[model samples]
Target: MNIIVISSPQQELNEASIIGALFEHGLEVFHLRKPTYSIYDTEALIQAIEPKFRDRVVLHHHYALAEKYNLRGIHFTGHYVKSHSDQLTNWYDKAKQQAMTVSGSKHQLKELETLEVPYNYVFLSPVFDSISKAGYKSNFADLKSIEKYKSATQLIALGGISLDKIDQVKRMGFDGAAVLGTVWEKPAQAIAVFMELKAAWEKKDQIF
Candidate 1:
């Protein structure tokens, strides 16, 4: 089970330092998602991170930075894909040519069926009640349906993921788990939570 961490939407104190620590502690993927950031602001944030770990970073916006920084991949939001339908093929082809992983977010299971291009993985969110978004309860109830879809493409469980919920995610047949609010809400204890989650994930793997 791959453990992915998403950056807080807004910058937090010592954000770069925390990111560097996450890499040192074996965080495999870090998604840089800042919806309101200008291109320059995004670039500055990336620059702030240690150069050695840049390749492990994924961009939610600023697709061009994937090449500029030799990033791990680029993640497309559902809205972005829908708005740029005509350019999806080109983006996919370019990402492949650059040998970068491609991923996206899908809120609905039905949307996964409609994806024309292959993604290395896709985030299926609100699997449980959201930690970051108020009042955003889990809408996922069909584990059987999720398992059925997992066979076609790698599905990563996102939203409200925590150490305790890791086992539940694995039992549901998800390929990976993504963390956001659980880490950011208490950045001071982020490392401890991350280590706990990682240990739980590895222990689960050992059993199954």
Candidate 2:
């Protein structure tokens, strides 16, 4: 199972340095999802990361940054999918040709149950109660009952993900897990926590 780490929506002290450490320590995908940051602020942060590791970064906003950097991928939140329907259709073909990882977000299983656009992967959230956002609880009554959707697009379990919960996520038929609070809740411990999560995720294949 893949271990995807998402950036904290709120900025962190020594954020860029911490991110650089993450990249150096085998973090494959880092979603840069700052919702309220300005273009200049985002650009400045990007510039701080090592150029070689920038390709592992995915932009959730200021997509134009992709044009300026060899970033890994671009993701569309559910809102983006709904608001920019035309843009998604036109961009997918081009994105495929460039070997870019394009993803989308969905809150409901019904959305993935349909023949949605082929995102490299899409995040299905609130698999467990969210630790990043207070009171943002899991939406499904029984996550164990979730059958994997049939489609080329991979499904990633998001919200409330942590090292111990990785097994539950994989058992739920998710392609992977995306984490936020587990890492950012204690910024000083981000790398330590990430290593533990990554190890757990990699070990899942040894099980059923």
Candidate 3:
């Protein structure tokens, strides 16, 4: 299992309330995906958080903060990944040298194929349904086809991954999961939900 990453809310962009809850439940990596926030706002939040988690959490779209804060790594959205291909020339080799991990999002087979961005992992989405972004659901069968690209990219399933679908998701062979509404809507219940999903995955392992 890679990790269960919590995507920061665009509306609130409040990292303080989430850090304590996520840390208590042993969440190591976080993706601050608020595209609306200015880099300054993201930095202020990271400044407040990095001291507590050390090198565990990461901020997305806040590349300037990466060096100053010593974040885990950077996460690139599909837009960033696609548009910055030329910029990422020799990135794979460089990333290996720097000991840094990169991640990006993919919604189409074409996007997945073009994901030669030298990132450590990839997130394929709406395996079921999404709350934040409606109509983001991809065909389940097509989503499963993503496994063929696993050799090139570590695929973390996102969107609609819930307690009930954990077993099926594991069977689909995703590297990990990235959750948003399921965790953010009720921060206090984060641990319980994490436990339930973990249990489902664990139980599935037993039967196999």
Candidate 4:
């Protein structure tokens, strides 16, 4: 599974250092998910890292940043999809014209089931309770139900993902996993977590 890290500084993490670690660990897909941050803060972040990762990083909930920073694409939230689905479709169509992929979030299997449009991937969350978003729960048993939609959509599991859960996610047949707290707690430790997850995934693949 491909690993994606959400951008945030956990209690001990320095944002820049963590981001740098992600790159070092071969994490190519990053979601700049600072929803509560001001534009200036977000802009500064984009200015700092976007240049180095021009084609690899993805900004979440910020379409303007993508156009301004030469990012790969934007990861839309459920609110964005529901509120501006049509408008975003045009954006995606235009992006596709340029060979870019558009991704989104789907909290429930029904959300994934209801989509009549195209989204490159949908991040389904709470595969387990995560430190980043506490109280959220992941229904792992529902994976079998979600697999039915694989033909029409690519699912990326999010929320509380860590090295240990790699096998469970793979068995569920997810296309990828997006990590936040697991790597954000210590930027320097990010690569280690990533390496372990990769190694675990490799082992799982060998077993299956």
Candidate 5:
């Protein structure tokens, strides 16, 4: 399973430093998803990351920065998908022309059935209880049903993912897992937590 780290919605102390360390420690993909940041703020944040590792970063908004910074891709949120339904086809074509990878988030399995464009991957959240959101519990009860949708596109497990649950995610056939609260809860120890998760994921891969 691929281990992805998402930037905290709100900036944290030494945020850029934490992200830089994560890249050095083998973080392959870093999702920069600051909802409130203006385009300039987002540009500044991306600029702060080391240039060599900037290609591994994915943006949630300010997609125009993808080409400017040579980012890995762009992620569309559920709201963006719904609100821009009419413009998605044109947007997808343009993103493809730029050689950018495309991904999106879907809160429900039903949403996957209606996806018009093929994405590199899509995040299906709350697979387990949410670590960051209080009382946002997992609604996943039938893993078999999730497997059926694998033919449509790669599905990534999000929400409440932690070291202990990495195996569960793989067993359920998720292409990857996204980490948020577990890493941000202790920013100083985030790299350690990620290493542990990465080690466990590798072990599981070896077993299978």
Candidate 6:
């Protein structure tokens, strides 16, 4: 299972170095999501990362930066897609032209039926409540129901994907998981926490 790490919305101490460290420690994908940051600020953050590792990064805002930095991909939040439905198709075409991965976020299963573009992976969020955001609860009563959607796009379970929840996430038939709070809630131990989650995900075949 892929472990896609979502960046903290705000800056953290030694952020760039820690990001570089994450790459060194075998983190495959890192989502850079800073809603309030200007394009220039986002550019600088990307520049701060080592040149070689930049390709593994994905932007949640200022998506053009993905092309500028030759980053991995661009992400579409559920809100952004709703607000820019007309432009969504054009953006997907553009992203494909650039040979970059494309991912989208969805809060409701109904939204999946309306998808015009097949995202490389789509985040089905609040799968088990949100550890990062208080009161953001899982929207589904039976996650197993999502198995039918797997043929449409790779489904990534976002929200509340902590070290202990990996087993539950797997059982729900999710393709992978997008983690936020498990690492950001304790920045100093981000790398350690990520390692544990990665190990748990990798060993699920043995443990289950």
Total clashing pairs for each candidate: 0, 0, 0, 1, 0, 0
lDDT of 4 at 129: 79
RMSD per candidate (Å) reads 1.7, 1.9, 2.8, 2.5, 1.8, 1.5
Residue-by-residue lDDT tens digits, candidate 3, 88-185:
55544544455557777777556666656656777777677885666776546545445566765688888887777776777788878877877666
**Residue 117 lDDT in candidate 2:** 70
Local accuracy of candidate 4 as per-residue lDDT tens digits, 181-206: 88766666777887777667667455
Error of 2 at 136 (Å): 0.8
Per-residue lDDT tens digits of candidate 1, residues 141-202? 65544676765568999999988899888888888899999889999988888888888777
Using all chains and alpha carbons, the TM-scores for the candidates as numbered come to: 0.95, 0.92, 0.84, 0.87, 0.94, 0.95
lDDT of 3 at 50: 41
**How well does candidate 4 match the true structure, expressed as C-alpha RMSD?**
2.5
Question: In candidate 5, what residue range of length 10 has the lowest lDDT sum?
Answer: 199-208
- lDDT for position 35 in model 1: 96
Q: Between prediction 2 and prediction 6, which has the larger TM-score?
A: 6
Candidate 5 ranges with C-alpha deviation above 4 Å: 205-208
- Candidate 4 Cα outliers beyond 4 Å, as residue runs: 9-13, 139-145
**Structural RMSD, model 5:** 1.8
* Residue 77, candidate 2: alpha-carbon lDDT: 83
- Count steric clashes of candidate 1: 0
Model 5 steric clash total: 0
Residue 118 CA error for candidate 4 (Å)? 0.9
Residue 85 displacement in candidate 1 (angstroms) = 1.4
